[model samples]
Target: MQARTVFITGASRGIGAALARGLAADGHRVALAARDGDALVELAAETGGLAVPLDVTDGAALPAAVAAAEAALGPIEVLINNAGVSGSAPLARTDDALWARTLAVNLEAPFRLCRAVVPGMVERGFGRVIFIASNAGLTGYAYTSAYCASKHGVIGLCRALAVELARSGVTVNAICPGFVDTPMAQAAVDTIARTTGRDPAQARQALERLSPQRRLIEPAEVVHAVRSLLPEAARGINGHALALDGGQTLY
Candidate 1:
């Protein structure tokens, strides 16, 4: 694969961090973006990449961050829309603020970032836009209406954009992982333990069992999937929600 400029959001830790490291190791110039400036800076130093700290939910900040990244790393050849928030609440308890915030971070942020970088990708006749979505996107889960709705919208956006960019040499895809062993998943486990009477271990086990593999997906596994999608050979694999869920949702 040719060395290209890459921009990754939510890149302070977990899957996002792993992807940044993987791409950097492969000789790509990477720009790491997240709300955590210190973490992003450390990761950028370690990977020899650029760090642009910004909150993805802040619409006004995105364009500036993109500009800073492009200035530092050249045009973004690959974009990883990985920043997201997850919350659990029944429909009756899911308030408007929660719904809107979820949509903004999970859906609108990626939409805006794609809008920022994709036109450049099209003009250059090369680009990869990958969304780190969730298995919740493929199927509905109880008490996670906001997260599910936002992620489903992400898949919908990927499909529609893929069709529009079919002749443009830019491929769009989403990765849906099941209960990845990330800080986000651990937070979900903590929430379950607090909401129900279950112990933390039991809450984690319940989540693991949701996948047929009965194990939490690793950040590296998701990184490998991202690597697969970056090559020119993957140009034909567009608009796919590639599941990394260990066969949890067989669609």
Candidate 2:
């Protein structure tokens, strides 16, 4: 693939950072966005990409961030909405604030980003949008009502944009991964350990067992999926919530 301007949210660490490095290695001019300004600057220096410190939940900041990225790198041809928040709570305990925040970060932010980027892509006759969703979007979990609802909303938005942009040379898709070996996953493990009186390792293993492969997914796997969807060769792969889980949602 030829070098294109790529913008990734949550690019400071974990899957988003991994994707930024992978795409940069593939010769794309990248614009990295996240709340971690220090990490973003470091990664930007390392990858030779622009760092735009952004909090995705701040709706007012989205346009300026996109403009800055476009000014520095170029019109964003690839958008990776990887910034997300996960909250695990039973339906009864899931308060309004958690529900609102989960939806804001995981769903509404992506929608806003897509709105900000897709028009230019349409005019340029090319674009790719990838949502870093979760398997919770595909299947219900015991104590993840808000998380599931947010991810499900993301998939819905992805499909809607994919269809709307189908003829305009842009493709929108969601990559729903199961529990991955990221800081977020580690936090979940820590939470389980704190609440259930299990060792951290045991808590982690419980997550791993969610996938039949019995292991947490590596960030590289998600990077590969995003890379696959970005190229012209994968043009037909639109409007689909591509599951990155190891058959966790196969049923």
Candidate 3:
């Protein structure tokens, strides 16, 4: 693959960090992003990439960040919307504020970021857009109303945007991962303990059963899915919610 600059959100940890490291070694320039400046800086240095620390939910910061990146590197040939909020609550318990916050972080933030950079991608006639979504997006998960809804919205956004930009040579797609071995996933496991008083190992086992593989997914597995989008040949695979859940959704 030709060396291209990639701008990724939520590069501080989890699959985002793995993707950054993987892409950098593949001869691609990566722009590290997250709410934490310190974390972003360390991730960038680790990969010899650029650090553009900012919250994805902030609309005002996006254009400036994109411009700065374009000036420092070239126009972003790849954009990864990986930042998201996981809010778990019963459907009846979900308040308007919780719903709004979920949309802001998981849906609206990526929507705005895509709007900011897609124009340039269309002009350049080359770009790759990947959304790091969740299996909750494809199906319902108990007590995670906000999370499931936000991720479902993300998939909708990707599908529509893919069609809109089909002729522009920019591909938009979402990767839905199931119970990945990340801090976020760990928090979900902790939720099991709190809800039913299960031990840590038992709680983890609950999540493991959600996937047919009966184990938490590795970060590298999800990273590999993101890298698949960078190739020229993968342009045909747009507007899809790819399941990287170890066949969890087969049931």
Q: Which model is ahead, 1 or 3, in terms of lDDT?
A: 1
User: Which candidate leads in lDDT?
Assistant: 1
The best-first sequence of candidates by lDDT reads 1, 2, 3
Clashing residue pairs in candidate 2 are none
Q: Where is model 1 more than 4 Å wrong at Cα?
A: none
Model 3 lDDT tens row, 174-227: 999998899998998898899899999999999999888899889999888888
True-structure RMSD, every candidate = 1.0, 0.9, 1.0
Q: lDDT per prediction?
A: 0.94, 0.92, 0.90
Q: How accurate locally is residue 5 in candidate 1, as Cα lDDT from 0 to 100? A: 95
TM-score of each: 0.98, 0.98, 0.97
Tens digits of lDDT, candidate 2, 180-224: 899999999999999999998899988888888888899999999
